[model samples]
Target: MNHLGSHKLNNVLGQILLAKRMGKTRVIAETGAGQHGVATAASAAKFGMKTYALFSENDQVAPVYSISAGLAYPGVGPEHAFFKDSGRVEYVAATDDEAVDALLLLTRKEGILPAIESSHAIAEAVKRAPQLSKDNIIIVNVSGRGDKDVAAIADYLEKRNTKNQE
Candidate 1:
């Protein structure tokens, strides 16, 4: 409903919360640049569907730089493109090192080990914070737990350090 908040809407849409009503086993979708395919796959898995595109595990995969599974797609979808064209959104990027550094900073200061996907937002907020007035607020979605990424991040850092020493 129009009066429902975003959190409520998410709960209603989440298959776990409304399984009887919203659970679906099949999806028909068209994708370009792979974003819709990834989302469709994710949705299918969440709805207890047995399969997703290509991958046996229905796992979302991405290139090394974007180790965040959900965000591993090649580009934003049509709606996002429309938003960009309309100047409703300003897209920016963060390097793997920047995201890693931001992740560490947040963990050390706030005791929250945000997901690697979220670390990019943290990096962006950090970049823009100095330019904005002190009263402004920036909200970064820490979408998932960081524990799973700890080993990967550690290996990445170790490799980077070893390379720097060479």
Candidate 2:
């Protein structure tokens, strides 16, 4: 796959198109940083699958990008948009914790793991989801690893401590 900034979404779109040719009817995924969300929605649209995405609170991109891309697909609609756009399928949760609760409910009702962008959140969400004995199926986008997040976390914590002491 091409790096985040590259237009490597073509690879994903190819896969979705192939799946559609093979008779697959739906596609689902999760997003964190918005890159994967945009890509997945585009792919689902390409394949004409009923696409659904689940995004985390940390997502920094507009959901409309993903939603519109999905809606542009033959069978998909804004309702399945996970990131942005206004429709029944798109659901915005207050936090990752809340998204997890919704994912758990979805797993119970749908028997599938909803897509999410964070690898860290996926396992926990899957475990919390009903009937998910194993969390291996949850695909985490892993946009940035712990090494990348450490400096940011430390900075935030230090600022938080300073604010608390003030």
Error of 2 at 122 (Å): 17
Candidate 2 per-residue lDDT over residues 1-166, each given as its tens digit: 5444636376557657665775666665554345655776766765567766665455554434221121222222222432233343333223433433444455577565544324225445455556665544555353433444335445555775798799
Tell me the whole-model lDDT of each prediction, alpha carbons only: 0.63, 0.48
Error of 1 at 136 (Å): 1.3
Residue pairs in candidate 1 whose N, alpha carbon or C atoms collide under 3 angstroms? none
lDDT of 1 by residue, 1-166 (tens): 4232222224223432333244434433333334445554455465665333333244544433365565654433334444555689898988888898999999999999998989989999999999999899988888888998999899988998999999
**Candidate 2 lDDT score relative to the true structure:** 0.48
TM-score of 1: 0.60
Residue 52 in candidate 1 has what lDDT?
30
Top-TM-score candidate index: 1
All candidates: CA RMSD (Å): 11.2, 12.5
